[model samples]
Target: MVAGDRILMHLQGRSALVVGGTSGVGEATAERLVAEGCTVVITGRDVVKGRAAAQRIGAVFCRADVRDVDAMIAAVDTAADLGAMGVLVHCAGVGHAARTIGRDCAYSSAHSLDDFRETIDINLVGTFNAVRLAASAIARTDPDELGQRGAIVLTSSLAAMVGQTGQAAYAASKAGQLGLLLPLARDLSSKGIRVNAVVPGGMDTAIYGPEGPSEALRRAVSDAAIFPKRMGRPAEFASLVVELLRNDYINASAVELAAGTVQLPR
Candidate 1:
């Protein structure tokens, strides 16, 4: 490989599949990958959003929910068909606000067991489902000079480390991603695939959808930020992901993209 090609712009001629690519961080990452000359396939359950994002970023759209085993496998297949499945960025996740223990009321009551399980199922299990299926396909690819077959970027949240009042399920789910990283990386080492997780703090994303945070809650979250005094940008998250993919040395670690925010205890 040429000197420049070895270091910078390693994503050129690569192939990537981004789950949850219909919006937010996934969409931004897909766009960045496309700009880097990577063939990209994006998957999401929202067909309209997925197709729009795919068209916007010059990528193919596969409607797959991360929780669906067969559907996720198919999405991986769609990406692997492009080339070797060089990168799998899993940005699909869901979050809700419910305290584990609270006052006796419908909405204010303690977190339900069913809610916790659903969160775990969608966020943690869903992530692993995609990772396992994608890693299998990626493992089949011929390794590069460095014996690197591919890289996997899993999305975690800062709440995994320090959670807020109502973040029991979300934090547990995201923390599970971090927990899986080391073992998954070690297990896939023989296959020349690298696994890493990104822990992001508050970000300007539609993960909350229309019923997002109230003005008071938003201020509280933003005020906790240390430097720059604002929530993270999706592009910023994407840039870090691209960097991790280019640098083969970064593996099995959870990189925090929190901007030094020290969240106050609830």
Candidate 2:
């Protein structure tokens, strides 16, 4: 697609909802939507980040936690009140990594049960929950000239395919998103809606642990001699998402932005 080509969706006069748009790829995509003429609403748990992102992108901000069904529903309702939603971008996700056997999984010993379950709740179930709610609103909107009312672009990690030594919970959560796309595609086809996902490999995002690499995690990522050059930039991930949301043909699937680093285990 050339720069001269009109953006596939042309988003002008339409509304879009971007969850987790407070930072990284989500924030960037939201800005692009506004530039292309869409009224955008971005949600996140961070009020400061969310407000800053919205202000920067010329869009509105609605604080939300994807795991909170009520919060997501409110955000969706806000978007609908603004206008018919032309796009739904779910870029909200969090990462977790721990050697499965070593980490304390038991809540019985006064250890927190929050870690593993929270990852799944926020990254996997949250995506699923928000998509259905967004679809409900999108379905209400009449189709555009091409019979497309909206498209949903979800975020998953390369870990979805690459089950490293760690990331047991994170990988499982992300993979769930991939599993949902095809079925979601079929389910939403008649409603003029589409679902898809972006899988990013090792990124330069601040999600990196403060203490740096865990011994086991390091070996796992480097074991295949992949990503040896360096981690990928956040912008690289953002661009593909923009393309997917633009093209109506792209739906109910996932595109990996990882640099061929994640070879599926045989």
Residue-by-residue lDDT tens digits, candidate 2, 39-80: 999999989878988888898999999888888899999999
Instruction: Provide the TM-score for each candidate, comma-separated.
Output: 0.93, 0.84
Per-residue C-alpha lDDT of model 1 across residues 128-196, encoded as one tens digit per residue:
999999989988888887677889999999999998888889989998999999999999999888888
How many clashes (backbone N, Cα, C below 3 Å) per candidate? 0, 0
**Residue pairs in steric clash, candidate 1?**
none
- RMSD of each predicted structure: 2.4, 4.4
Error of 1 at 112 (Å): 1.7
| Model 2 TM-score, all chains together | 0.84
Least accurate 10 contiguous residues by lDDT in model 2? 103-112
